[model samples]
Target: MYSTQGIEAIATVTELRSKTSALIDQAKTIKTGIMIQKNNEPEAVLLSYDLYLKLYKQLEKSSK
Candidate 1:
């Protein structure tokens, strides 16, 4: 199961540009996800690539 807590570090599209690096740093430090917002509404998510790849591999193995 996944938790929304990992994906709630939101930043608007405009602010994203400036905060992107910091966001990445945060994700790296926390080993979690972040939510991106557009117009004050949730739009997308940012996840730790390492975690995503790990989960992906698990799913791939399970699907086999």
Candidate 2:
């Protein structure tokens, strides 16, 4: 999972499983990714498609 200071939203695995649609909607509305935690540790991140593409492009450019 991507790590950065000041991440304001988080969800546990169980929460994500039960409220996938709602959490996704919230992420889109907030325009920020949600960090998913498992076993009380960060496991993955859920980012909107646009944001993922943007970050991917940035990484690609930086690696060039």
Listed in order, each prediction's TM-score against the native is 0.69, 0.85
Q: Identify the candidate with maximal TM-score.
A: 2
| lDDT per residue (tens digit) for residues 7-48 in model 1 | 546667877788888887776655556777777777777777
lDDT of 2 by residue, 1-64 (tens): 4564555699999999999999888777656688899998888888888888988999999999
* Top lDDT prediction, candidate number: 2
Clashes of each: 0, 0
Which residue pairs in model 1 clash with each other? Answer: none
